[model samples]
Target: MASAARPQGFTDDIVQRRVHRQRDQFLQCITKEKVLAIASSRRPGLSCDYFKDPERGSYNLCCFVAFEDGQRWVIRIPLAPCLAWGARSKLEREIATMQFIADKATIPLPKVYAYQLGDGLDPLSSFVILEYVDGRPLSATEVDSLSVDERARLYELLADVYIQLRRHIPFHRLFDDLEGLRPSEIQARYGQRGVLSSATEYTTMLLNLSDNALSNTRSRILDQEQGDDVLYHHHLFRRFVKEDWLDKRLDDGPFVRVHGDLQPFNCMVDERMEITSVLDWEWSRVVPVQYFQPPLWFTGHSTEFLALGYPYLRYLERLDEFLRIMRELEVQKYGDDLLSQEWEHQKSSGGFLVANALENWTDIDRFSTRHINRVWFRGTKDAPKRIETFIREDPTRRDLVERLCRAHEIYKKELQQLDGTSDPGDSATTPDPFPRRPFFGTWESSVPGIITTTLALGSLIIAITFGVWKKRNL
Candidate 1:
């Protein structure tokens, strides 16, 4: 969902961004000629006008370029370097997923007019031209302003989008991302990953990725604090999930699709308050059910509003209302409504507490053992000595790399459609998979940022829950 009301600051921000784009930094990255080519090549012999002001979201630099006489398209250039955490394979995945949804579901997503994938380090040439959507974002102010029935009707439309995705998109494999990659790439990386064998696998892989990310410093954008707290929180969250606290009933996987950043800005709606197009598929992925939470709209929160006090209570009430309506519709169509069930189970298990803390960079420290507990060996004077001891004697830590390598082999093999004749993991028995990487590598890692950088920890939590066992109680 959007916001209570797009403050006047929104307009000012756009103007400021336009001015910022004119600066040398962004000009060096975006070339008018290249933007023109992307637009012109898609539709030749049209009166094309390159719009000078491009919209810069954290994920991409979007510009409206040369257009057909009757229609318009948007060229989105990802803001991250191709080498960034989510940037590597994101475009290919986004393009593939958008196309798949367009073909299979009634969900209104932008059609890909044309696209160019990024090279290993290039951001300029990587662009996707999508049919320009003409709609406003559904804002909390708008939803709250509505009568109860009006809001319900809007939620109905939103629910259908989720329903269609669940009904049509096959669970081919558990994907942390849903954007498309070449089958060749898929085959090479994970063997055709043609199976959604279990939920445990999905969560583990996500946790592994998250673990590696947190251990790296370059990703420590959220916390400039040079402390052990981030790692401690990582340890605590891992411990909590693995203990009997997680929603066990729903932990069994057939990973479900999530519009990773289903914030209001991406959810475009017509005047009638319906989902016209969901922008930005780059972050879309098949998250494990345990990690799943209600879309941000229902939560009435954003990066702008990060607390869980009143907003969270309001979220509960709104969620119940929305799900009740969605459940009725879902049952009528499919006779089963696992989505609603998963949401309830997840909330009851308090998984979102970890999610909110981990996802919000500023809040991560609050969950650390030091803040929550001072008597344990972890929080006591023996803490430093204990960490070293745990690092050396912790069986799970010693074999984490090997375990990940094996899991990757399973992923690669399953995707490749190959017989499992050989599977050899990493040769080194290093405690850290990405020991040299910065940010998240500290104790647990690095800290949080926006929607994209959590993969390392994302995988870490999943692993704790499903893939790796807690050998010793911390």
Candidate 2:
């Protein structure tokens, strides 16, 4: 293949600015007396069809070059400054981990050529030189573009990949802290009897934290106080949930690696309809022995203006099928009984969204465009007219849904009983109580006390005044 010329116009300056940092990082990682600077040729026929803003601006700018010796390689320069808070170091370590897995693991992950931490163009920038796999990102469009049998075959191949990865790479060894420990030793240290045990613990902690955070945020909103603590707790909870959930549920299991950002778009299918390559390991982590079902965007809307096809629901269905296959595989490997046990544990621990405060839920209904808030039954014309229409048409589903809604209403009334019952007189206060320290922690840590104390003191003058204030505002 002939080497293409440099891309034109404004893009030229951007490339020129980033090139120095790319080369610098390369030199730093691989100290060679002599280095060959690959030409920056713009590869045609591909575009980044990213729906969301690529976080950290870590998009790769590369030109596919087939050298005179008929060697095909991609020279990729990653943009974005090294984040101040040691994220660059974390990323560098991750790159090393990926290289280690590629070389040692049974699975065929990306082969890394070189990783360099750069300076000049984008200081704290990093560049990775890798062997470019020839394929397109996977999505419903790409899957539908293939024959039905081909799609099934691709999924089967992916399932096999998961099985092999889980079997070969034990979860404890994949993460930090246990990098040097033998799997058995690490398991002993964590008191994890097996992969499932660790996963259950991790998932349970994260969900509980999320529940507490959401509960606190709801309380603050109800009291009409814009306390920074409430907002901070919510943010912290979201972060913890994302990290812990990934670690325990996805990263802990050797079976399914949480391909952190997998949503079909990061997958690629070759001419043979096989997944040629999985792209973007930026968010990739070892996960539970399940198929990929990564989260979607907040609004979960697709950009129609972009020429690339968008089939959101179809992609979700495909993902669900993939997860189902993994679940079946896990059941086959262990027992259907074990899978059921793990699932039941997950439910009891609130691994899934169980309850929502009526007020908070109403806010979501009024605000969110995400599918979770999709209307099941509403008289509004603004949203999609499906659930109501379905209820109007189907007798059984409508009746069952109505019964469920009534039950939910009853639950709501039951919750209100404890709203104003707190009485501090039940416990005496001590004098000079350490001069009340400055409040500076998260809502998760504080809101529980606030709610409890507020209710307990409702008979007091202060509590009565606050209640009157709320009523007056109402």
Candidate 3:
């Protein structure tokens, strides 16, 4: 069967072109002889053909260099924009993570042959050469197509990998150690420190992506409605940050080394359905153990798809089986029930709730308050009461609540308009209620200038206030 055509607005043409241009420039910097020399240590007299991977990644471009003898290697070039945005150190961190896992864990990963940062011959290029594993990414359709026995076998393989990953002890500090790499040098290269220890620190780091840094630097031509959307998200996030109850819960666990990006596409499997390799460890970090849950792709539904109609419910049987398998594995390894512990902790801490909230903030429909309350506050009736105190005490909290209410009203009106329904409440059942919008076309037209100006002013005020507070505290 042929792959379905990607929906409009789903393509990353600009990023793709940038990646291809960088690939071409890096290829130009070296001759066939130079390429042969780089691989000569592993494969003598290695003449090769190079082709870029058709499936493009967000930050790196992968190219296959196949030798005449049928041996293949993968060269991953960090895209120029990514490097400029401090991804060189991220790449280095990934290399360090792979090396550490190779030494400490039983999980299979690509063997890194060589890595290079900009030098005299190619001052702007950075790439990693690794042994190529011949396997395809396991898709949701592929998972559904598998036999029951085959799916079980695949789950076992994945479970073994997960167990090993979790069993490996976390580093005392959050940062991975790359030999001969200085902390200052790493910070200089990345424009920020690499390490994180506490949950507050980790949450702050993730929040920074939505903060003034990206908002101010992002192209002004982006959709105006996006500003209001962002403000709405910030309002939700501020609750998590300001409420001591939420912050303490967020900060309530021991750090564990986690494969932060473990979506299905990152895992490779051969015809036998055994995991051949796991790719992309750039975002791996020492985070709280509460984050070390099952892969989000197990349900075979994206968050966007979930917002449409809770489509993941169609895979409920499979999800149940997957959870059973995980629970059995966890019991065998740790002599405790995984799901029960996770559920108990989630109820008390709302860790997963807050995480899902953060991850799906941009798509509020997917992370609605009703869903969060059902999942995280199932047995507790004091949910509103818990936040009630914060709303009463903090003027900022009250302001955010008002902003959130106003934003939701606007969102409902937009949904009603799209659905062609007079009653906004009826919009939920409207077919294809929220068609995907282009990234640059996400801003609202009415209040773009006002939102931008307000954000800038607010950011400046916060910066000044922080400076004064720090000085006085010191």
Highest-scoring model, TM-score? 1
lDDT of 3 at 74: 77
Return the top candidate by lDDT: 1
Model 3: residues with Cα > 4 Å off, grouped in runs: 1-37, 50-56, 68-70, 85-88, 119-125, 172-197, 213-230, 240-252, 307-317, 338-340, 343-353, 356-474
Provide the RMSD of all predictions against the true structure, rounded to 1 decimal. 15.3, 22.4, 13.5
Off by over 4 Å in 1: 1-29, 66-68, 80-88, 118-124, 175-197, 205-231, 247-252, 302-311, 355-364, 367-474
Please list all clashing residue pairs in model 3, or write none if there are none.
223-443, 224-443, 224-444, 225-443, 225-444, 226-443
Question: In candidate 3, what residue range of length 10 has the lowest lDDT sum?
Answer: 456-465
User: For every model shown, what is its TM-score relative to the native structure?
Assistant: 0.64, 0.43, 0.62
Task: Summarize candidate 2's per-residue lDDT along 276-395 as a digit string, tens digits.
Answer: 765555544543343222233211333221101124444345556655665676677755534333433433212322211111122222122222223221322433233334345657
For candidate 1, the C-alpha RMSD (Å) to the true structure equals 15.3
- Mind giving the per-residue lDDT tens digits that candidate 1 earns over 1-474? 001122111011222222333332433645667677667766678767765356545455667664546677777776553123444355666666666677678888887766665564445656667777777666655677887777888888888877776667645446343211122233233444433345554444333434444443331322212223345445655665556444455555555566665665567877877678877666556655555556655655642332333455566788788889889988898898877776666654234655554444344444333232332233446555545455466665534434444544554444344233253221212132111222111111112233332222221111112111113111
Task: Name the runs in model 2 displaced over 4 angstroms.
Answer: 1-59, 82-91, 104-106, 118-125, 144-146, 173-256, 286-474
Q: Count residue pairs with overlapping backbones in model 3.
A: 6
lDDT (10s digit) by residue, model 3, range 139-236: 65577778899988888777777767666654443442221112233334443455555566555544553343223322221222433333333544
Instruction: Please give the clash total of every predicted structure, in order.
Output: 50, 13, 6
